[model samples]
Target: MTDARRASGKNHYLWGDHCDGWRLIDGPDLSLREERIPPGCAETPHVHHVARQIFYVLAGELTIQLPGRTVVAAAGEAVEIAPGQPHLVRNVGNQDLRLLLVSSPDTAGDRHAAEPPGLP
Candidate 1:
């Protein structure tokens, strides 16, 4: 049997400067989450060894910083981060940023934090 999921009814946890995340789908092969990032805050740069992820913006704007450039994903836009690519997500707009993050093969223990921007 399949059960419908709703963000309002899902459990949320705090992450990174009061940001919130709700796990919409949890499984071994795939994971889906809805996240909220407050203005001026950012996630740390990191990479997944085996999981590839796509981040879809639902509200406000998201700044995805990569190796050589930064990608601005406005509402209704999405960006993908391939495995082993170091990246970070930030809320550069003056409002909260809402987005859906989908990970294939689940991140699990595959996250590796990289040095922050402009650092060696």
Candidate 2:
């Protein structure tokens, strides 16, 4: 039988100025995580070398910025990012933002920061 993992039973990591991430499934080919970002926190824009990723909003709202566009994803909505696309996710609400991040072929050591035009 395969083991089941829950957020309460998984390992947690802190990142991005008070954000928390729980690794629900960590594998070489794929990874699934539940992440929480407090209001006003934003991830720096970056690109993945090979992994494509999807962000599913569980609670609150997420402002996802791409190279030429920005999208707002609310609860139950998801956004897909192609590999090599420069993007970032930010919590622009007053409450905590909970989301699920799914990465294919893994994202470990595959990220590179990039400067988006007109963004500091």
Please list the residue runs of candidate 2 whose C-alpha ends up more than 4 Å from where it truly belongs after superposition: 1-10, 117-120
Misplaced by over 4 Å in model 1 are 1-10, 117-120
> Which model scores highest in lDDT?
2
**Could you give me the TM-score of model 1 versus the true structure?**
0.88
Q: Each candidate's TM vs. the true structure?
A: 0.88, 0.88
Least accurate 10 contiguous residues by lDDT in model 1: 1-10
How much is 17 displaced in model 1, in angstroms? 0.7
Model 2 weakest lDDT span, ten residues long: 1-10
The lDDT of each candidate is 0.86, 0.87
lDDT tens string, model 1, 1-120?
Answer: 112244346466778897888888989899999888999999888889899999999999999888878889899999999998888889989998989999998998989998654412
